[model samples]
Target: PAVVNKIAAGEVIERPASVIKELLENSLDALSTRIDVDIEEGGTELIRIADDGEGIPADELPLAVTSHATSKLRQADDLFCVQTMGFRGEALASISEVSHFKIRSRTAEDHVGSELAVTCGERSDIRPIGCAPGTQIEIRQLFCNTPVRRKFLKRASTEFGYISEQFTRIALACPRMQLSLTHNGKSVHRLPATNELTERLTLFYGSQTVEQLIPIEAEHGGVRLWGYVGHPSLNKSTRKSQYLFLNGRYIQDRSLQHALNEAYRGLLMTGRHPVAFLFLEMPSDQIDVNVHPTKSEVRFRDQQFLFRLLLSTLRTKFLQSD
Candidate 1:
């Protein structure tokens, strides 16, 4: 079992950024409104996340990290999920297999919190601890037991860059969630909770860039789309700036990507991609998000319809003069 767990960790956790994404997802699943993250040595040494959300009960702490013992979606449904669900099953288990993992959490009703620690798949008995009303998780020495995996890690600066990118994606997806990030001992980002998406855009991109963005809002055929699309002047050399969130879950779809490019076809020069922060809302039955465990890709039931809708929406918006 230990060997299998280590193998799974190798597949799921490719880097510190991957770990960051999983932990952040868990926090969001817990309904955390405020999340604080601290990283040391680019998350090779330590990564700590504290969130103010409903915490795990004392009795459930063990099951939370149990391998392949998911308490969510045990039975496959005929239709794609009607709601966006967090991937909580193998994440904690795989993460614990590769690093020193500890979790301390308390609910509003509990007098005290419970703490659990796992060192390379060796879990300790749960113990009571004093903590605030929420959850705090610490991961230390990532890939420590797997020296081969650790060997492939890039430099601290480069790895942190990846972590920052992941953080940026989540922050943009959930604008109202208070998020803060610290590296080593210095603060990198201290974003206050805001319903305003432009505030986040300005924080990540410059204020000067935000001013040139075009706002899009439209609904058709039971699908609603709204977000900020960068003007042609703000085109990027790469597609990294494009973010499309479906039901608040970050996703990647080739049709959607192609549609975006097509929308800016004549506006952008060759080799340049449009900068966009697009949100999509539609009935869950019309799409299949079971494509990847990472939840980054989904299959739409009507691919051509989406492609045409997205392309026409942006193209038509750009045609109108502000």
Candidate 2:
């Protein structure tokens, strides 16, 4: 069982950035209004996430690290409509399998908090402590025991770059959540909760970049799309700026990309991609997010309809601006 967990951990945690992504998702799942992420040595030496959300009860601290123990899914039907971010129940368990994990949590009912520590799948300690009314998780020496895995890690700078990108992606998806990131004790990003999408974009990109974008809002056939689409003059050499969120979850889909590009056809230069941050909202039953373990790809029931809706919406926006 231990060996199996370690193997699964490798799949779920490809690198230090992967670990940060899982931790951020878990924090978001906790309904945290404010989340702080701190990392060192590209997250290999240490990674910490603190969230101001509903903390776990003292009794549930131990079980929280147990395999397949999740609060997100109450029944089988919940799988079809997973609105929460961390539902698989495998993230903490798998992460603890290969790292030194510790969690301190205090619920509103508790006067004091409880702390649990696990070292590479073995419980080291569990005790009561003083803490704020929330959860703080610290992971250290990630992949230290797995020499082969550690060998595959990139340099600290390169790995940190990936971590930064992941942080931006999560921040973009949840613009109304207060999020901050620190690396080696230096502040990387500090974003306060705001309902304005353009404000969040300005924080990542500059004010000039935001000015180059055009607002998009449209609703049709039980689906709604809203966000900022870059003008043709603001096209990029890479598609990194193209972000699509379906039902509050960031996703990558070729069909949606094709639709977007088609909307920009004849407007953009060859080999250039338009910058966009689009959010699509529809009934949860109309799409499926369980196709992949990472939940980065989703399947829509009516792909053609969605494509047409996106294309037409962007085309109309472009035409109006012109």
Q: Compose the digit string of candidate 1's lDDT tens values, residues 1-322.
A: 7787899888889999999988898788778899999999899998999999888889988988887666556334322332324454878899999999999999889999999999999989889999999999999999989999999999998999899888988899999999999999899999999999999888888899899899998898999999999998788898888999887878888899999988888888888889999999888777775676675788888999989888988888888943
Which candidate wins on TM-score? 2
User: What is the Å distance of residue 59 in model 1 from its true position?
Assistant: 1.2
What lDDT is obtained when candidate 2 is compared to the true structure? 0.87
C-alpha lDDT values of all predictions = 0.86, 0.87
The TM-score between candidate 2 and the true structure equals 0.96
Runs in model 1 lying further than 4 Å from the true structure: 73-84
Error of 2 at 84 (Å): 1.5
TM-scores for every predicted model: 0.94, 0.96
The residue pairs that clash in candidate 1, if any, are none
